[model samples]
Target: MLPLSYAIRNLLRSKSRLAQTVGGSALVVLLVMAAVAINQGMSRVLSASGSPNNVILLGTGSEESVQRSEVSENTTGIASASIPGIQEILGVRAVSGEIHFMNYISSDDGSRAQALIRGVSPAILHVHPEVRLTQGRFPAAGEVMVGRLAWRNLGLKQDRLKIGTSITLNDQTLRVVGRFAAPGTVMESEIWAAIGDIRVVAQRETISCVVIRLEDPEDFSEVDLFAKQRLDLELSALRESDYYGRLSEFFSPLRAMIWITVSLIALGAVFGGIHTLYAAFASRVREMGTLQAIGFGRTTLLLSLLQESTLACLTGTLLASTLAMLLLDGLTVPFSIGTFSIEINSTVALIGILSGLLLGIIGVIPPAIRCLKPALPTALRS
Candidate 1:
């Protein structure tokens, strides 16, 4: 058996090859970690955005997208009275009629970007308990409240969305009165204003949806029955969680594209690493033959080679993990619906480490076997 020092020394024999192996592995592992982070971040935000105890009443044909749904403004009042199992705080029922509008908003500096805007009343707080004001207070008649992460979606800086600042929406200027946060949810990337203000700006007589919070999740059937009985309202009842879950499914193709892109890139890097390892081992054939003639088994030589390759790949894994933590962790990324923060938690890190180990093992076998295949006498002649 070769000493551990033998594998270590062989790795340093060619600094260029060592660097190539390490760099290749690092790039592949980093890509995998990034893909995992993106998919996890998007999924986490969507799932957390909805509450099981809540139901969304959308216009019958627009159940898939709240922004596209339009219900009569009077439905909010009617549902509040008709829904029997609804939660109540004091005399007020936990129901909110909201308007969701997505359009270009302009900063004070004249830069415009698309943002998800929500129009709500104070009753929204009762329905969505997760939202809390982090700075200033909720919006008044002509003012707006920005989410702590809304700046990212607007392509602006933090200072741009600060309280007292102003933004242009639908050619109407509105003051920024506060910042709110709904942690781990897409709501953190939205802009909120008074329902009347948005209704005027969006030029719609109807609201997007009416969200109601039930005392118990099991009471959903009662609400569903109401929607079914009221044929004139043209309403559809859906659990809030199920709504967001369907959104996740709707984005399946985008996630699949991400995985496909990462897989293709990683495959190329793996082949390149294998070729480099094979060439490096091919040049060391005579040395392996000499060791074989000295009573060292071919299996031992193969194991030593694997040890060297694994060491380099594992080092790259460490490098990739560090880079991902520094660059990707907690980074906010915006999409059509909202923004999510990439978090390289323990699970993502573990997957990255395992990917590195696989690269080490899979990348070495073919090259290692071929180099150690020749008989001791024939190999020495070469």
Candidate 2:
């Protein structure tokens, strides 16, 4: 068998071809990683929107979004009373009536950006424990707690998020009193305030949604049935996980568009890979023949060619992954599903590696087998 060093030497001998193959594959991997990153980031943000133990009550037929839902104020009282299997801390049941609002916010310079405002009670802090105040106190009535990402993206500092610094909302100015962080969640992109304050500002008479903490996840069916049967409340219950999964439906088409585009680009790259590897093998036909004549088996020639192709693809994968981590880490891309920042995680790394190896194997096999088919005398002619 030909030693591994022989494959290395063969690849090194044709540096330009190797670079072309590697660089092409790298561009392909880069595109694939970027698409997958968007999908992964979206999944992370939407999944993180809900807690594992919580159940949500949305307006009947409000399947896509909480914003579209209308849960009546009176329903909150009935839900708390009638809903069984709710977990409690001390003596209080875990339920919160929340209002969701969106408003335009700006820097002191007047550069405007959109922010989602979640109105909640003190219990909200307990509901979403991931939220941490990095500066100032929790928002008081008439004040807001901006997320860290929101602050950074909007170019506001803690002091800039001043006690009296006001942001216009529905023609009313609301004070910014604090800043918080809820890492890796959609909450990171929002501003939070007292429910009463937002209701007054938005002129809203109804709460947006009701969230209840369940004793166990299995309690979903019971709660869901109860909520759906309550014609008086006109509400429906969704397990938090299922709610997010439904929310993921918003991104499904966008994700499909991305995968389709990636597939087309990968198709081109695969063909390019095949062409490059075939050319590389064709040019080295004499070398392969020489090796075979020297008693290197056909299997050795095949493995050597495969190793070469694999090395090129692997190099491209690493390049793409590194570029994604460094350049696109916190870069947000706007999509109809939801705006998501690219996230590069270990899972993405693994996917990229597998993608590269698959491309290599698919591209090199035909050419490698062709190289091994010719008799040594016939191969030497080339």
Candidate 3:
């Protein structure tokens, strides 16, 4: 059997081939890691955004999107009074009627971008306890509060949305009064304002939905029953967690598209890596024949070849992991609904390492088998 040093020395024999193998593997693994991060980030944010104890009252037939749903402005008052078992803080019910508006807003420099804006009263804080004010205070009339990561969605610099900066919505200028954080939730990318301000700017008489936090998750049955019995309100009740779960399912096609695109690109890279490995191994055919003549079995020779390839691929994996940690991890990505941060957590890192190992093993089989196929005597002559 060949020593481990022999495989290591052979890898360094041709600098260009080594570089090609490592670089190709790195690119492929990096792509896989990125795709995993995106899908996971999107899923994590959506799942974390909703709480099981909360329920959303959406207009009938508009359950898919809150931005499109329209409920009566008085629904908040009616639901708070009618719904039993709702969470109460200091004798105040946890019911928030919010207006979700998506529209173009202009920055101070006249840069325009579409943003997800939510109009809410102070009751929102009770319904969404995950939100915490990191700076200044909650938005007041004629003012707005930006989420800590909202700048990413707005396509502006962080300082541009900082306190004291102003943004224009529907030609109305609103000052940024505060910054808030809702870790791991899509709300982190939204802009919040006073409910009346949004109503005036959006020119909507109806609110988007009514969000209610219940004392117990089991209380959802009562909420559902209420929605069913209240035929005048034209309302449908859905658990907050179920709503976001549906959103995740809605984005399944997008995630599939990402995977499909990565697979096609990786297929090309794999074929190219195969050609490189074949060429690198083919050049050593006579060497392999000489080793076989010296009592080394075909299995040992194949293992040595695999060892060399796997080493190169593992090295590429390390490179990809480093790059992902530095560039992709914790980066916020904005989509139509909201923004989610890419997190290269343990699971994602493990997936990348496994991908590299698979590339190393599967990529070398055909090339190794072909290179070892020649008869001993004829191969020695070459």
Candidate 4:
């Protein structure tokens, strides 16, 4: 077998070509990572936002979005009293009367951006155990608890959403008295305010929806029965998980487009890498023949050449992975409903590395074969 040093020396032989190969490989690897992050991040956000045992009651026509839903203030009482399997937390019914509002909010720095604000009673926390207040307390009237990514989705910096920072909601100025984290979920891109305060400020007299947690997820039929039986209320019931699943389906096309775009560009890079490898190996035919004559054989030389390509690809992937960790991990991307942090976790990194290694092997094959196609005499003479 050819010494591994020979492959390393060949890569070091042409600095310019090596740089081109490595740079191209890095860009392709980065594109693949970005695609994975976007797909997985969106998937995670949707999945984290829902629990199967939870049920949402909204206006009949507004089942698709809570923002458009308007349910009766009495709906919570009706469901909590009538639903047989409702979960009770500390003797309090796990029912949240929430008002969802979206409007342009101005940060303390006077920067304005669109924001999703949730008006909720204290029971919201009881309903959603995932929300943990990292700083300050839950919001009161004239105050708001910013979700960790709320400011980012609003295009404001982290400092603008911190405790004591104030933001304008229409003509009203609401202080950010707290910060909460609901990791991997859309709730992390919302501002929580007291239900009464938002109703007064947003000029809405009706609650948006009533969220109910069930002791048995399968007991959804009871909630459905309530919504069905109450014709005057004009209500509909949806499982929280199914709602987010539909949301995920809605974003599928967008994610597909990202993958398609990345794939096309990566294909171009693959072909370009092939051309580069062909040129690099073609120039080393005489060197390869010398190795073959020394009992290394064509297979040994081919493996050595493959090792060079894989080394360059692996190095480029490492660089791309580093860049992704620094710039993309924890980066918040705002979507239709809210924002989700791009989690560059192990699964994503592993997929990216495997993609790069596969690209290296696949891209090297034709070029490697082409370089060895000629007779030993012909190759050595070239």
TM-score of each: 0.97, 0.87, 0.97, 0.92
Candidate 1 at 299: error in angstroms? 2.6
lDDT (C-alpha) at residue 276 in model 1: 96
How would you encode candidate 1's per-residue C-alpha lDDT over 208-239 as one tens digit per residue? Answer: 99999999999999889989999999999999
User: 2 or 3, which is superior by TM-score?
Assistant: 3
RMSD of each: 1.2, 3.0, 1.2, 2.1
lDDT scores in order: 0.93, 0.78, 0.93, 0.88
Off by over 4 Å in 2: 151-165, 328-343
At residue 244, give the lDDT of candidate 4: 93
Candidate 1 Cα deviation (angstroms), residue 200: 0.9
- Residues 125-202 of candidate 3 have per-residue lDDT tens digits of 999988999999999998999998899988888888989999999989999999999998989999999999999999
Q: Which of candidates 2 and 4 reaches a greater lDDT?
A: 4
lDDT of 2 by residue, 343-379 (tens): 7778777888898898888989988887778888999
RMSD of 2: 3.0
lDDT of 1 at 108: 88
Candidate 1 vs 2: which has more lDDT: 1
Instruction: Encode model 4's per-residue lDDT on 241-323: one tens digit a residue.
Output: 98999899989999999989999999999999999888888887787777666767788778988998998888889989999
